[model samples]
Target: MHWIKTLKYYLKSLGPGFIIASVVLGPGSITVSSRIGSEHGYAFLWVILLAAISMVIYTSMGSRFGVSNKDSILQSIAGNYGRWFSAVIGIAAFLAASSFQFGNNLGVGIAMEGITGVDERVWPLIFTPLAIVLLFWAKNLYKLLEKLMMVLVMVMIVAFFFNLVLTKPDVGEIAKGFVPSSFSFDSLDIIAALVGTTFVLHGALYQSYLAQKRGWKVGDIKKGLSDSYTGISLLALISVLIIITSASALYPNGITVNSAADMALQLEALFGSYAKVIFSIGLCSAAFSSLMVNAVMGGGLLADGLGLGSTMDEKMPKIFTTIALLMGMLIAVFFRGNIIYTLILAQASSILAVPLIAIGMFLILNNKKVMGKLKNNLWQNVLAVFGFLLISIMVYFMYGKIITYIQSLS
Candidate 1:
């Protein structure tokens, strides 16, 4: 009976982390993981392991910050630094959210199009408005978003795990992937993609808000850690499954995965039709779940940064969230130019904002006055410095590629 009560408490405390898992593992992430699996085989599985460790460390920081402070992340920035500091974080978040929102819009539409035989372009028209309606319709936005993300996370696990079981990935090769000697500069670009997609500090920043939204307090740290671990582990596990599935099914055949859809089509060619449907189910879940939460994170941050209001039911947050959805939908529907390039640019800009956000978060968590008893431990501080250096290296690596890509276009 006591164990059952403990289980109920754990279940009740399980919202923010699951949201982090679902929102971070969006279509773009799936595509990146697929490409890594197909091109590099299991050799780079260590990257996901590295990313999961880094994310768990950072998200733990975010969760503590959420419980330790009554203010939003941005509001805390304003108090300690100034309004200008918070504003910078807010605007950057909104721009990045709005930009990547295009992909989510296109993603949901694409997943539907793949299944329903409708043009992907037409599907966003129907779905984006529904997202807006969902924003307005929710009496308590956090509860709704949490429940929705849970279902999506379960969908991804089931759909991708089913395919993974089918692949029968080489147990020995997969084991070798965990050895760091397998890493190489040749795969540095995809390595950055994996890290950027997984060690998403922006999502970490949002974790604080989600915790507070759950009505968490300083005493809830144990439960918060539980949720964080569960969420991050699921994220790493699902990503590994996607990569493993591709490595087994496509890497040996030398099929390059250009998209999530590419992985599905190629899987079907090898494993028959069920592969496509199963993979597509995972894709749809990823896209739709990300579609809603992207706006919530972006708009909520923007409003708080601007000193408008971070609460979703508030007028400003809703307006900003709706704008994010519309921005993505219009670009997804009306853009006649190169789609992938646009997504890359959007994501790149967002990645650029992460260092500032991460540094600010670290400072807050370390502040004795701010965190009190929760201030940074020796291990957390060590990881923060190390993570910073790693991110600096990645940014340099990614920036060079973006420059070369643009130069090629010119």
Candidate 2:
């Protein structure tokens, strides 16, 4: 009975983690994971494990920051590190979120288009306004977003798991994939994608805000840790499932999908028409969830960065949120391209602000004054540094690619 009570308490402490999980497990995650699995056949499963550890480390830092400080993260940073640095993080996060916002809008439309043949462009026009309405009109925006993410994350779990089940993967091969086989330089692109998608600093940074919204305190760190584990575990499980499903279903036949929606549509040839529908439903869930939450994160962080306000119930956060929402929709409608835009956005983020966002939480967590007794332990520090180095390497390769991409544009 006591154990049952403990489980219930942890369950009750679940909102914030779901938010992180839902945003990380977005359409981009699915597409990239699918590509890795389809082309490499689970050769890089170890990357997800490494990323999960990195994610857990930073997420815990964010959670600690949320509980240890009464002020928003940006506000705390301002006091300790100066407002200019905090503003950089805030602006970078907003731009990163805004850039990805384009893909999410198109993803929602594409997934719907795959199912109903409704013409992909039309869905974004409808969904974006609907997202704005909910973002502005919803009472207790934090709780609403939390519950919404929970539902969406579960939908993603069920949908992706369904696809995995259809693949009927080899458990032994999947296990062996975790043992990190040596690969060539050709694999760097996929490895980077897997890391970039999973070890996401932006989503981890938002964990602080989410924890604050949950009204967690010092006493609730245990629950916060539990929530972090649960969310990242869900994230890992979904990514692994997507990989195995694609590896089993497509790798053998050398069928690489251009989009996640394309993966669903192609599955129809192997399974049945309904397979595509189920996958599309999952894809739509991922996109719509990301479309709404990404804007909120961008808006709220940028608002607080500009010294407007932080809390969701406040006018400024919602106003900024609306701007992000509109920005994504407009970009998606105007450009109407998917793959190139996603790569550019991903690169832009890494180059612009992710390195700072990744390092900021570690600095804050380790500071004796700011974190006090909640300061990160030695193992956390070691892992955080390792994570930072990994990201630095990722950025190196990405910088070269960005240069080539830009030159091609001109």
Candidate 3:
């Protein structure tokens, strides 16, 4: 009976946390992790570990908004802040997220070329259409995309371990990266990149809606917590492996790459030409996982903003999915170079938005009319406040840099 109950819980927890974890596997993460390894080797591994732990805690806060309120974050925003504000957020989020689709599409194409020994230019034409078809066939339903993400997870984990075997890293140096060291501005840009890579915006925002759609009530807090922990743990595991493999082989040779293809080349330098094949396999899975999750998120945001409920008729789902697929394809075709710049800018924008969302959710959850007995406890409020302030400061730093850059351009 106990085993049966556990199995049931796993099935129940599937769609929400899994999708969130899937988005975390995007090009932002793969490139940044690879860069970390190539530059400082194992010295930067602690950043990934810290970000993974922070993600688990923050993801819980966002997910609880749905479990307790029975509303998606966007829905709640629309109800309290009015449609204008929601529209502003929706537009901003869509544009930012669309840029990511382009980045991932490009990343996937590059990864394929490395493995197949083909020209990079040919891959974008092949992958964009295929991804559109895959997404179109799914109808953008969260449950279906969630399942696809799970399959990608299996493929990626297998590829990760295989790459680790090819690298055969020194465990001692890997251990040393965990010790907290003093900050240096030379590495600050890298640190910022890692932070942005780990804290994905669409994943966090979509999680609340996913939980509500899955019928997770405030009573299921313990179950939701378990699911979040599991999701973040998987992310941490992959992050560690990427860093380990790259640092062990690429760093000593001073080979730094800005994309997944570059990382694949570095891997080949270490293990052999076959190493590129293994990297390509893992990269494809990572990009696919992110693409699937983000497509669903974009559709859900549009539908919910238009006042659609959790249960839509068959036609509505198809419409939303088609719109999302088209948008993703358009972005992919137009997205050119500047992968690092795009990621950094998107993350900085998200950090600016998080504080407002956090504070609003806290107020709503505490409202007696809304949550009643489901109001936040002292600890929950404490966590939310801390997240709010932490993001606010990060945003300030990031925004300052943007302003400086603009001023210089002028």
lDDT of each: 0.83, 0.82, 0.68
The candidate with the higher lDDT, 1 or 3, is: 1
Q: Which ranges in model 3 have alpha carbons more than 4 Å from their true place?
A: 1-12, 134-140, 306-353, 400-410
How many angstroms is residue 384 displaced in model 1 relative to the true structure, after the best TM-score fit?
Answer: 1.5
Question: Candidate 1's residue-wise lDDT over 1-410, tens digit each?
Answer: 99999998888779999998887887777877887899889878898898888889889998998888888878888899889988888887777566567778777876886777688899889888888888998788788889989999999999999999888889999999888876678767767777866787778889999888888899999988889999999999998999899999999999988766778889889888888888888888998888889888888888988999978878898888888888888888987666655554445445655777778888888888889999899999998877777676777787777777778778
* Residue 186, candidate 1: alpha-carbon lDDT: 72
**Residue-wise C-alpha lDDT for candidate 3, range 167-201, written one tens digit per residue:** 78898888998875735766655665666566655
Clash counts for the predictions, in order: 0, 0, 0
lDDT of 3 at 122: 66
Which candidate leads the pack in lDDT? 1
Least accurate 10 contiguous residues by lDDT in model 1: 341-350
Worst 10 residues of 3 by lDDT: 309-318
Candidates 2 and 3 compared: the better one by lDDT is 2
The CA root-mean-square deviation of candidate 2, after full C-alpha superposition on the true structure, stands at 1.9
Compared with the true structure, the alpha-carbon lDDT of candidate 3 equals 0.68
